[model samples]
Target: MTQTPDETASDAGSQLLDAALMHVPFDGWSDTAFRAAIEDTGIAPAVARGLFPRGAIDLAAAFHRRGDDAMVTALQQHDLSTMRFRDQVTLAVRLRLEAVEDKEAVRRGATLFALPMHAAEGARLVWGTADRIWTALGDTSRDINWYTKRATLSGVYSSTVLYWLGDDSLEHQATWAFLDRRIGDVMQIEKTKAQLRKAPGLSSVLKRADSLLSRVKAPKSKHSNLPGGWTVPR
Candidate 1:
């Protein structure tokens, strides 16, 4: 059977990316590496540009997404039935970083996204990864908690990736230790929030707040093209 146009394009993009990976460490995710990959793959120039309009930037984005896909697949196979919620989340972040085949590729992509113009895109990718992890863990949040969960995990995942990249300890033990500390900090914040919610003076105030926030639903998967989804109280 003939491949659909989108499928064909995806195949070409994967080919280009696989070839590009060989050159990425040497040249970073730059135009030179992209061009060399095109040559290596023998994919036409127009087709390559059509597939990656922003050239190497798009390639870097694709790479990050590929890692996210791998992490999700790994999460599906894990036996998380016995772990605490915190350990489950920590394992998710750990698997994400472990999915990377080359730390230097991430280092290069990080530098690229650090530029003012690309920072937003970089952030979006990080949030996307965090979103995938939460979804894989069977998160059922539908209100403001949806956004908050992803936002909080994004921070933890991003910091852990940075630490992991620089870590030289055996099997990156130090990075895992650092990740545990960050997760502990987030858990403490959550504990405080739980206490505040139950406090006599704050209970009524927070209940009112939660009523308003409940109107802010999770973006439906079909309508996710929008940044967010919500319903205003009449």
Candidate 2:
């Protein structure tokens, strides 16, 4: 069987990444690690550079996305039938962290992404992870809630990861406790939102807001007409 260009590129990138991981802990996703991966994989320098144009930054992104992919696969295999929605979310986040093969690699990636030039990329990766988790957990929100849900979970996941990195408790129990508290805080906000939805004067205001936001639809995979305005009455 012949391989497509994309397939070939993907295989090359994965190979390079696998080799690069060996050096990331010491090199912190720097050019040195990328160069070493090229040498280790015996891939053509041009091809490796083509696969990762920005070098280590792209490798770091691939590493994060690979973890997300693993999390999605794990979520699909798990039985969440009896779990509360909050517990499901917590488990998804935990599964994401558990997908990592090496904590030091993550620490190095975190340091690389924390640089000013890469901060936006870091945020994008974090948001992507949150989006993946929500999608895997069967989130059907099509309104403003779609954005809000991911944004809120992004904060939770990022904070939990940072806490987990520093946590030395048995099995990172402290981090899980911290995650539960954060989720509890979010649930409390949700409770307050439900209360506001039933309030006297505030109810009307929120209703109008919800009405406007209801028209905002989630984007389809192919072509997206998101934030579509002024839907014609049926």
Candidate 3:
């Protein structure tokens, strides 16, 4: 398939973002990473800034898009149609996060997005991810349900990302457990909505769809919270 101009641009941006990761923890998502990556890759500042106007946040967003792209590619190996909708969503979330090898990258990404001015941008990024996941899972929502589905999954994906950051349990066991719970909560809400389709209870369940998930603390395995070498807890 011939790639479009936008696809070409996106690939170039991802290459720059990958180079920037080495500097993310040190120089952060801002100028240092940007300059170093551009210098190394010879990407013009005008073009780089054009793609990532908000500096590090734009790089962070690119990193996030990379993850989403990876997740979609990985899902191609599985027949999502064979899985339950909830399971498909669960796998999508896991595969997306699995692309991040450096914990600090996520830590930095979270910090970049947590700024008050960027809150809406952060939400939009999550929504885009949810939309992609749903579309990849063969969702047919074309109405208000589209908004509601994305909104609900955003809660799940964002919360799971938070949990994953601190996960010290072997292979992110704690994080996956937290994700399962969140997915289950969504599943329950969906069930409730179906049952209440003809009643007035859907409003309440929809409201609850964005429920507050409790923070998941890292597991206290013998391995300890080593900063650089984060091994999957045995």
TM-score of every model versus the real structure: 0.95, 0.92, 0.77
Q: Candidate 1 lDDT (Cα, whole model)?
A: 0.94
TM-score-wise, the better of 1 and 2 is 1
Return whichever of 1 and 3 wins on lDDT: 1
User: Per-residue alpha-carbon lDDT of model 1 for 78-169, expressed as tens digits?
Assistant: 99999999999999999999999999999999998999999999999999999999999999988889999999999999899888888999
Model 2 global lDDT (CA atoms, 0 to 1): 0.90
Worst 10 residues of 1 by lDDT: 221-230
Off by over 4 Å in 1: 1-4
Tens digit of per-residue lDDT, candidate 3, span 1-234:
999989978877877888899898897777788889888778888888887787677888878887888899998888766787778888989998987777898888788789898788888789889988988887764444556778899999999999898888999999988999998998888788677755685756645543321122222332566311223333
Candidate 1 clashes: the total is: 0
Model 2 clashing-pair count: 0
Indicate whether candidate 2 or candidate 3 has the larger TM-score.
2
Sorted on TM-score, best first, the list reads 1, 2, 3
Candidate 3 lDDT at 81 equals 62
lDDT of 2 by residue, 68-142 (tens): 999999999999999999999999999999899999999998888889999999998999999999988888876
Measured with C-alpha atoms, the lDDT of residue 207 in candidate 3 is 50
